[model samples]
Each structure stands twice: as structure tokens, then as C-alpha cells.
Target: MNDFTPSRRSFLAGSAAAGASLVIGLNAKGALAAGHDGALVPNPFVKIAPDGTVTVIIKHFEMGQGTTTGLATLVAEEMDADWDALQIEFAPADASKYANTLFGMQGTGGSTAMANSYMQYRQAGAAARAMLMEAASLEWAVRASEITIDKGVVRHGDVSAGFGELVGKVKETAEPPSEPILKEPKDFKLIGQDLLPRKDTPAKTDGTAIFAMDVAPEGAIYAVMARAPRFGGTVASLDDSAALEVPGVSAVKETPKGVVVYATDTWAAMQGRDALSIEWDFSNAEGRSTEEMEAEYAAALDGDGPVARDDAGVAEALETGTAVEAEFDFPFLAHAPMETMNCVVQAKDGKVHIWDGSQFPTVTQMAVGAVTGVGPENTSIETVYAGGSFGRRANMDSDYHVEAAMAAIALGTDQPVKLVWTREDDVRGGYYRPMVKHRVKMAVGADGKLAAWQSDVASKSIFTGTPMEEMIVHDGVDHSTVEGVSDTQYAIPAMKVSVRNMETPVPVLWWRSVGHSHSGYAMEVAMDMAAEAAGADPVAFREELLAGSPRLLGVLKLAAEKAGWGNDLPDGWGRGVAVHPSFNSYVAQVAEVSTDADGRVKLERIVAAVDCGVAVNPDVIRAQVEGAIGYGLSHAMRQKITLDSGEVVQSNFPDYEPLRINDMPKIEVHIVASAEAPTGIGEPGLPPAAPAVANAIFAATGKRIMRLPMVDAGVEFA
Candidate 1:
């Protein structure tokens, strides 16, 4: 066996664990009994048991993003371990043990799990592999390099040892590799391969998946809240006599913002809340309609707002008789995940425990701990599967989680009480995407090259009143609202971008793609307009303007080539293109659309090219791209949430409809292979779709669409 020497520190670390107690148990006669111990490990990603079983604990909650599978891929790749023999489990509430490397909290959002934890998990796998290899080498009396590993077996020519047989001899004497040699792309056997279905897919499809709503502890009660109709409004008084008369109605409590109705079941709680008579104090400031907010935003554009980006001599370029100006309007939007907002909490013995399908568990735990005067460590958060969270589950203040915890504490109930918000409640809830207005002015030189560009955006700051309000905004300009506009790819000599943060009584939060959603639309549409004014094809014009950006130009050319950009189409069909670079990745899209005789818009196909660099799983990346296209088309065609006197006009699917199957277009995705590090894919596909469709609309009808929900503006597809 090779002499595997250990450092003094490693030996001392192992010696310190000599007093640790190990427990082993068996269920029936031969059935395996799950082991549980109070002792916690710092890196709980993997645990080796005495019985030859390997358990991998995942910290992030899975919500259809395939995080569990992706994390496992990282572990398996570095460990050179047998994937079929590994067992996966969810980690317990231990923030210190599994702190997020990116945000320093135990949560999942921003499409960061795979990209941030890739190396960390790989190192974990390498550590375990080293220990196992050393043990096997010792047993066989051969050098570690002579022992080849495959399918959980270490072999030396005629001799072989299973990982289970070597576990007892494999002392934990190996240190994590500081710079482990990562596997080459060509050597990846399972990462990009389409393996079997995900571990949770069957359970989810069969309705056996345990979401927060399905988590009902024994003797648990239910509660429904009647929040203020207008945000920031408070409840004056509640007449609970009618609610008490209902069968199974238990009690009603008045909270800071509203009244909570407690009952035996969810139906009873909802019915009791409906029966209660409550008066709201909205006299301080009546809520304004969406139209009023849009007008205010439009008026704010005329004022001198904070300049996010300004180049020298933009005014002189505008006066050079080559300037073009246009305006774009983006409406407010809702997350509208499949599962509504819900949280189950139980507060007792100076401690609080919560089971929630939240994206920001650490944030929720901290918020609950601070409000109830409990220690942060004492607050336990159990994450469940979220049906969907497009940045909705990671609210800045943990509004839903705090409200649920407060309700449970106020009730003083030993049983866990779940607070469920109805679909209507979710729709009218405070947080929403801010309505924005964009004014863009650009100049093209005599050579048909982009010379100067100017843009001003007016919108309510999403972070103004949140925890990150102070960190992201400087001099009254919210950087989130002008991200894509300020960092555009064109090689303009002079440019200026301003953002006006308009104050609104309504609450606003981050939606999918965040500021890039509106900024990309404005930028791309403005580019298309400039191209049209210069009497050039959109694809060729963008290529000319992108002379300084080879990466963006490459993707644009690929997308155009894939979509047959220069080829002729049907008489009524037209093509449009858009490109956006965000989150360190570049994406380009070409949309083919046609309008029927009745003016109905029909999106025939979409060609997307992405340069995200070395996709770990190309199929999944393509799926995300297709999904983004569908979502973008929904918003472009008919998805919007309007308000009338602080009340949401569209409540359900009948009005706030998503894209139907017939409305979906055929999508083709192309990935540009590179040796560079991988970038994000979840949100990169979103920014290009809206402008591509809008540009196509202009091509069909010779009309410029400045507003969203194209159907509302008499935009016909034919």
C-alpha cells in the first residue's frame, strides 16, 4: 500500500472525534433502519455510514428547477462514485452548517445553486473519494494510483474491494482538495447525458409530492386572513358575530394589518373570514388605479431624474439631424405561480418552527426570529417543494412568512396552524412588478452606424422600501430599472441613460428577468426602429452596430442564419430579431410572425441562439429557453394585471390568461460551445422575446406598439 501520510493538523482533527458516539440500528428482521443522531456535521452534503450506505443531503429546496439532480451531478462527477448506490435526503434546519456561498444564507433563488455551488460540491465529492481510495490501497498493499475505481469498486488487476467493505478501514484522514482537477467536458459521462426521470417527478405527477399545503400536522388548525383592501391600510374593527355563528369556527384575532379567522379546516376558515364584518381605515391615502400610476410615471419623465450613465457630447449628436425618438410602456405584472402563498407555523416554548414552500428560508427565519423576540438559531425552517416561484417567493420582507408566524404566535396554539391565501388574495397582494415608461432617442451616422443614444426610464423603485433599498439605489436612481439600457452592446460614441423613481402607494417587487425585462424591450425596439429608418434589414443593421462586440455579433448571426433571415417568407409573414446580454451571457432571438385576414397575430416559430459558455446540460438549457419564450409571448400578447381603485380587475385565469397550446410557437434553440465558464440560463432567454415580437408587429402593420398586452391595443396577427 502507498504510504498515505497525514499532516499534524489532520491527525489532530481526527483524534478530536475519538469521543464521538456512533449509533446503529435495524428495523424488522433484516430491514434497514434509518439512523438519526443529534450530532450535526458542518458539511452535511454527504455522510458515510458504517453500513456502507452513502447519504447526500441537499440544502436548497427543489421547485421544478431540477436543483436536486443538478447538485447530485456535481457530487457524482468529482467523487467518481456510483450514482445508483447514493441515497439523497433533505437537510435539517441548520443555517450555519449549509450557509449559501453566494448570499451567505440558506435559500434558493437568482438561478445561483448550480453556478455557485458547483466547485464546492465537487470538492466535497473529491474528499470522500480520496479517503476511500486510501483505504482500498492499504487493504490491497498496492499504490493508490494502481487502484482503478468504477461502479463503487476499487480494483487492482485480480483484486477488488467494494466501497461498503472498505468503509470501516477508510479513516477520515483526507483533506479537501484546494484545487481539484475538474473533469474535462469531453470526459463527462452523466452530466450532459439525459438520464432517467428526476427523483421527484413520479411523486409530483402522482399527487404525492408534499407541498406546504399538504403538510398537515396532527390536530393542526387552519387560518385565513382578511387583509386590507388597499395596501398600508389597517383594520379599524371587526364584527366576528357572523363568523362565530358558522360551524367549526373557533376564534378571530386582530393583527396589525388585518383579522385572522381560525377554524377546524381550510374551508371553514375561508367561510368565516367571508362572514366577518370589518371596516378598513383607508382615509389616509386612497389607493390609485393603474391608469393614474401610468400617468404619474409619464409626467415624471419630463423632469430631470438621476443620470445612471452619461457620455460626453450626447446633445450635440442629437442636433446633428440624424436623431430618432420613440417611447415604450410596460405594465405591472404578477408572479401567479401555480401554488398560491401558504405557510404553516407553530410557535411555542420560546421557539418557532415553520414549514413553508419559500425560496428565502433564511430570510424568513430571521424575520420571524426578530419579530417574536426569539433567537435566530432557535427558529427552525423546513423547506417544502414550491409549485413555482419567479422571484415571488423571495419577497424582501418575508411578508407571507412573518404574517403566518405572527398568526400562530397570537393564537397560542400547540398545533401547527397553516395560513392559506386564496387566489384572489395572491392577486391583490401588495408586491408587483413596477409599471415603467421608457423614452429612447438614438442617432445613426451617414454610414448607417449607431452614433449616439439616450434613454430615460420612469418607474417606482422596487427596492425603495425593502431591505436592499439603500444598497441598490444611489442619488434617487434604482440601478435595477436601467440595467440593460445602461450596459447595451452597441458601440455608440456618446450615450446617456437616466432613471426617474416615481413614488407610488402601491407596493412593487422583482419579477422574472427583473429590470432587464423592460430595458431589453426598449433597447431592442429602439434598435429596430433605427434600422427601419435607415432603410436596412434589422439583422444586417444589428451586425453593423455590433462591430465592437464579436460575442454578441456571433450569436446574432447564428440566430439569423438558423431562422433563414435573408430568405423570403409567405406574403403575410414577417421576421424580427433582438439580442440582449445579461448575467454575463449573451442571447439572440429571431421571431417569425404572421397576421391572418382577421388581424389575429400568429407566432409561427422562434429561433434562439445562446452563448452561455459550456452548457452542463444542453437539453435542460434548451427547455429553459423554450419556457422563457412561452412566458414572454404570454406577456407580449395578453397577460397583464390592471387595477381599478386599488382592486385588481382580473382575478382568475378567465381574464388573466396565459398562453394556450395553440398560441405556442415552434422553438429551436442553438448553444454556442466555448471553453469559458458557464453563465446563467434561467433568465437569459426572456429579454429578447418581447422586442422580437413587437418588431414583427411593426413589420406586419407598419405600426409602432408602445404598450404591452398587444391585443388591448388593437394589434392583429394577420
Candidate 2:
């Protein structure tokens, strides 16, 4: 038998002792979290057990972004570990154990998982590999440089030993080297491979993967709550006698936001919540509907706002030509992840334990601890796999998690409670992306070039009253509202951008692409309109204007070529295009659209080109591009969350719906080759999707879709 094959059966029988696992860190730059006693904590991300299994504990939560596979590939490539024997585990709640290398806190968001973990995880593998080689060197009594590893086997001349055999020797080593070697990308066997199926796919598909909602702790009780329909409204009074009388229904308590119904099971809790009668007091909130907000925003734009930027010579440029103006209106958006929002908390003996799929579990731990009076140090969070979370689970204040903890505290801590938000509740829930309106006036020179520009953005400040207020909000302006506009890609002689930060009772937050969700649509569609006004081809106009940005220009050319931008379409069909840069990645998209005999719009195809730098997994990249396309199209086509008389108007899927399969377009993704470090891939796909389709519609039928949910513009749906 070969040296490697003979150790297989023997390795399978060995197991690691609980205390023998090797613990190491990459560096002091947020890698090895120091404890209260200034001692090294045990956070073994790459652990080689005696049983020949390699376990990697990750800090970030995976919500369909393929971090599970992408991260595993990074470590395995560096360690030369056996891919078949690799396994993944979620890190437990301990700030000193698994802090994010970038944030110093145990949380995940901002598409920063791969960006931050890329070096740390790989270095961890290299350290482990070096430790194993040192063990093999001692056994063979040879220089460590003489030992080489291949497929989990360490070889020195005629002597050979598997990693499982050397792990015991590794345990005997006093300490690992502070600096370990990392592999060059050219030697990678798994990091860039797209065909390697993810390790979690089979379990997720076979229904064995346990999501947070699927978890059932011992003696768990179910909970359902009724939130005030109106923003800033409160429950004045509630009668829960009828709820208490129901079978399996145990108790009902009044939380700050609503009344929660606790029962023995989920069904009973839901039924009990339905039986309760509550009265809401919304005296302080009024005129919060979409119409009222639009009027307020328009007025704010007419007056002076907080000027974000102002360049000299704008007045002279405008004096040379009359102004061409355009306005774009955007409404509130809901995150609406498929699995909805749910949290399970156990508060007993002055300590709290939580099990949830939170993108920011550290925040959840801190929030629950504070609410339960247990202290952050006393709280423990067990992170579980999430179904999906665009950005809701990582709210600035952990709103949903705090509410769940409050309900659990009401249940006396001894009985664990699983607080759940139903589909209706989640849809009508607060924390939608703030409604916004953009107004821009431009002046062009005689040469058909942009001479002067002025832009005004008005919306509720996402950071004004949140925990991030002190850090982000400045001089009465929220930079997030005008990020894409203030940092316009096109060159102009004179430029100015301003924001009118308004206050509304409605809760708002950062959506999938945050500020770019609105700013990208406004800038892209506005550019298309400007091109048409100049009687120049949209592609040609943008190319000439964006000469300064080569990355964006390259994608524009590539996307146009792939989509046959200048080719004639079937009569009545039209093509539209848009390109944008956000989250340090550049993307360009072109959409082909046509109307059927019934005047219904049909999205035929979408061609997207991206430059996210060094593609980690081409399959995941394509999937994210396509998924974002669908998501953006759904919102632009019909999805909206409206309010009337201070109460939410939409209830469920039938009202606030997703794009059906038939409505989704055939998408082709092309990735530009480059050796640059990887940037974000999750949100950049969505920003340009709506504008590309909208611009195309304008090209086909001289109807400009200034407002979103093209339905509002009286456009018929396919």
C-alpha cells in the first residue's frame, strides 16, 4: 500500500482530546483577541484533530454568499489539507475568541467577510501547516527544511507520516511561530476553482442543515407579538383574557412597542396573538404617508440644504446655457428576507443565552444583555446559519433582537422564548429604506459637454438618530444620501451637491446597496436622459464623459459589446444601459426590453459585466450578479412599501410581491480579468439594474420612468 493510503483507516480511529487542540492566531492586528487578564485566548480557526479531520471555525455568518466554501478554500489551499476531510464550524459568542479582524468586534456585514478574512484565514492555515512540519521534523530527526507536505502527508526522504500521526507531536510543541509562510496564488489548487461544490450544499439541500428558526432549545416556549401599525405609535391598552383562555397559551406581557403573546408552541402563540385586542395611540405621528413626504421633500429641495460640495465657476458655466432639469423619486423599501426575523433567548440565573441567525451576533448579545439586566459579559450567543439577511439582522441598534429579549425577560428568564415575526408583520414592519427624492439641474456647453451641475437629495437621515450618528452624520448632512452623486464619475467644469436631511416618524435603514440603491438609479438614469437631450448615442455620450474612470469605462465597453448595444432589435424592442461604481467594485449592465401586444413590458435579457478584481469563485460571482439583477428588477417593477393615515398599507406577498419566475430576464454575466485584490460582490450588482431597464424603456417609448415601481408611471406589466 502507498504511504498515504495505509494511514487512512488508522487515522479514522483516532480522536482529539478536548484539551489537545492547537490554538494559534495570525497576528496582533485584531487577530489574537486579548482577554481581560491580558492572556491569549483559545481561538483555533484551523484545527487538525487526531482523527485526521480538519475543522475551521469562522466568525462571519453565511447567508447564501458562499463564505462557507470561499473561506474553506482559502485555508485548504495554504495548508495543502485534504479537501475531503475538511469541515466547518460556527464560532461561539466570545469577543476574545473570534473577533472580526477588521471591526475588533464579533460581527459581520458590509460585504467585509471575504475582504477581511482573506489574509487571516490563510495565515491560520500556513501556521498550522508549519506546526505539522515541525512535528514531522522531530520524529524523523531531520532538518525541518527537508520535510515536504503533500495531500496531508509529511515526507522526509524515505520516512513518511500523515498529519493525524503528527498531531500528537504538534500538541507537545511549546509554541507556534509568530510568522508562518503563505502560498502564492499561482500555486493555489482550490481558492479560484468554481466547480468545487460547497461543503454545506448537500446538507442544506437534504434538509439536514439547521437554521436558526429550526432550532428548538429544551423547554422552549413560542412567542408572537402585535406591533403598532403606525410609526411612533404605542399600544395604549391590550386585553389578553381571551388569549390566556386558549389552550397552550400561557402568558401575555406588554412590551414598549407592543403586546407579546407567549404560548407552549408556535401555533398557539400565533393564535393567541390573533385573539388579543389592543388599542394604539398615534397622536404624535401624522402626515407620514408617501404623498405628504414627497411634498415635504420637494419643498426642502427648493430651499438651501446642507451643501456637501461646491466647486467654483459653476455660475459662469450656467450663465453660458439654460438649465436642463430632472427629478427622481424613490420610495421606502423593505428587506423582506424569505425566512423573516426570529430570535430565541433564554434568560435564567442572571445570565442570558441566545440562539439566532443574526448578522451581528455581538450586537445581539450586548442588546439582549442590557435589556435583561444581565450585563454584556454575562451573555452568550450561539450563532446559527441564517436563511437570508440583506441587512436587516444587523440593524444599528439590534431592534428586533432587543424586542425579543424584552419579551423573554417578561417570561421570567426560566422559560426560554422564541420570538417570531410573521410574514404580515415583517412586511408592514418599520425600518424600511427611507423614501428619497433627487433633483438635479444641469447646463451643457456648446461642445455638448457637461458644463455645470447641481444636485439636491432630500430624505430621512439613516444615521441622524441611530447609534452611528456621532460617527457618520456631519454638519447637518447625511453623506450616504448623495454618495454616488457627490462622487460623480463624469467630469464637469462646475459641480455642487447638497442634501436636505428630513425627520419623519417612520423608521429607516440601509438596504441592500444602502445609499447607492437610490443614488445609483438617479445618477445612471439622469446620465441617460442627458445623453438623449444632447442627441448623442447613450453609450457614446457616457464613454466621452467617463474618460477619467478607466475601470468603469472598460465595463461599459465590455457590456455593450456583449449585449450588441448598437445592433438593431426586433421592431418595437429597445435597449438601455447603465454603469456604476460602489463598494470599490465597478459594474455595468444593459437590459433589453419590449412590449407585447397588450402594452405590457417584457424584460427579455440582461447583460452584466463586472470588475470585482481576482474572482474567487466564478459560479458564486455569476449567481450573485444574477440574484441582484432579479432583486433590483423586482423592486423597480412592482415592490413598494407605502403608508396611509400613519399605518402601513401592504400586508403580505400578494401585496408586496417578488418578481415571478416569468418576469426574471435571461442574464449573462462577464467578468473582466485582472490581478487586483477582491472587492465587494454582494451589493454592487443591484444598483445599476433598475436604471438600465428604465433607461431602455425610455429609449423604446419616449416615456421616462422618473419615479420607481414603473407601475406608478402607468406602465403595464407583463
Residue pairs with colliding backbones in model 2 are none
Counted clashes in each candidate structure: 8, 0
* Candidate 1 lDDT score at position 108: 74
Poorest 10 consecutive residues by lDDT, candidate 2: 1-10
lDDT of each: 0.76, 0.79
Give each model a TM-score. Answer: 0.91, 0.93
Write one digit per residue (lDDT tens) for candidate 1, span 295-337: 8888888888899989998888788837799988888887888
Alpha carbon RMSD to native, model 1: 8.0
Top candidate on TM-score is 2
Give the per-residue Cα lDDT of candidate 2 at 505: 80
TM-score of 1: 0.91
Q: Which stretches of candidate 1 lie over 4 Å from their true place?
A: 1-42, 49-53, 172-179, 194-196
